[model samples]
Target: MAIYSSAVFPPSQLWDYAVKLYNNPEVSAACLRLQDRRGLDVNMLLFSVWVAASGRGRLTDAEMIAGIEAGARWQADVVAPLRHVRRYLKGDIAPADNRLAAELGRGISDSELFAEHMELQFLNEILTRPATGSFGAAERGEAAADNLAAYLGHVTRDISRDDLSDLLQIWQQAFPGADPRLTGLFGPSLQ
Candidate 1:
């Protein structure tokens, strides 16, 4: 989790643009094709961005290790799942209100879990960066696509605490009962 400035990322018209790229049949086909041939997790650039934005997005250090262990893990398999996760975390859509409720078998969707995670991860301070970075359309598109790929990287595993100090305070306040160990994991700034 990173305490990104709202000035760094706010919700915006980019949402539609992102979805448009996401829903493109040809893009989907190309993605799927890439997945089958190169095994999806191909791009290091996507992984780098995802690793930066989402804090290993996985749930645990072990999971992070596993991802690294999965030699040749491309960024493809991770994109869609990351997109799916972002949709819930960013509040663009309610997780419980969607199809996820039917999949997790909890009478609740993973989205609900994610919504809380977003709070614990980034929203606890009542802070949310506007999606307003100076990244150009191409950069934004690249970020979105890579993030989508990262979704897959995280879903099958747990989140890590790589750059988590940026969000630890929020997590401490939002989930006072959170594991002391968990908070410790993201305690100090990397620098």
Candidate 2:
């Protein structure tokens, strides 16, 4: 894990914000859909949201790719396996006592949560100062959309416009009636 000598762009508050936003049932479902169907990184998705919310502008394509690479190993080896096990235990695919499965599920959930924290820490290592100068909500939204599109492009060469739109809509709805500064970044109406 990388250690920070000073406060990073996404301080603890923004991390907390990511956690809260991700925990929303709708947001969680959308994240899973993007992850399972589109091969998107949930952490990166949440990171983009954090960046937009914190007035950090948006990640460049290179930054998004680097961030994805930085966290790929831990995410694939630790988080994904834990998640697979937890989900497997939930289904009839695995035969185990209800009590034992439940206990193991809780442990797996904790491990996954810890792994996510580690991912966030890794991402913090590469954090840059928010973009200089003021930007309107629409501009920020466009930046975020572009960042997400770049990420999707990396995952699959043929990125679907509709999929991108759906993903953006999910993120926009995640935090409705947000702060005035952030409202425009989510969608046009909020702007």
Candidate 3:
């Protein structure tokens, strides 16, 4: 993972924002649910939110696709396998002793997290500069929604409205102060 300091990518503040958002339990749970159930990429989702929060306009479909593609190999070959190992160890499927399994699981989890950080670094490197203007919460939400939708379309042939709603609900919960227009976009179905 690339560590950013005052000397590196002076304008890149999205990584810090992403770290804070990912640290939130609600956001982490939502991201895991999206990944486990919908085959969505958690890194991309975080990237979308980071982009929007940083005042960048919604990423174009091409940009979203590019970001996903950039990290796909590392995600598939490294992170996914680490996650699978960790999850398998947590379940009855693992033949190892409980103590050993738990220890391995913790190590795998740490490795997976490190892999995620690397993906974030790759994403941060490719993102275009934020737009030179202020964006309200509503605009940020719209951009996040658009970017997420594009990612969904790229990953799955048939996009589910329910899944999208679930994502928005979590986003709303995580950011209750977001503009009402954003809440409206997700519709009244989200509670």
Q: Cα lDDT of all candidates, in order?
A: 0.35, 0.68, 0.72
What would the per-residue lDDT of candidate 3 be over residues 113-180, giving only the tens digit for each residue? 76777788788878657565688777777677666666777888765666765677556654567753
Residue 154's lDDT within candidate 3 is: 80
Q: Which stretches of candidate 3 lie above 4 Å from their native place?
A: 1-12, 92-95, 131-133, 173-175, 179-191
RMSD of each: 18.0, 6.1, 4.3
**Collision count for each candidate, in order:** 30, 0, 0
CA shift at 21, candidate 1, in angstroms?
1.6
Give the candidates in order of TM-score, highest first.
3, 2, 1
Best model number under lDDT: 3
Model 2 residue 46 distance off true place after TM-score fit, in angstroms: 1.2
Residue 122 in model 3: lDDT:
82
> Which model is ahead, 1 or 2, in terms of TM-score?
2
lDDT of 3 at 180: 34
- Error (Å) of candidate 2 at residue 137 is 2.2
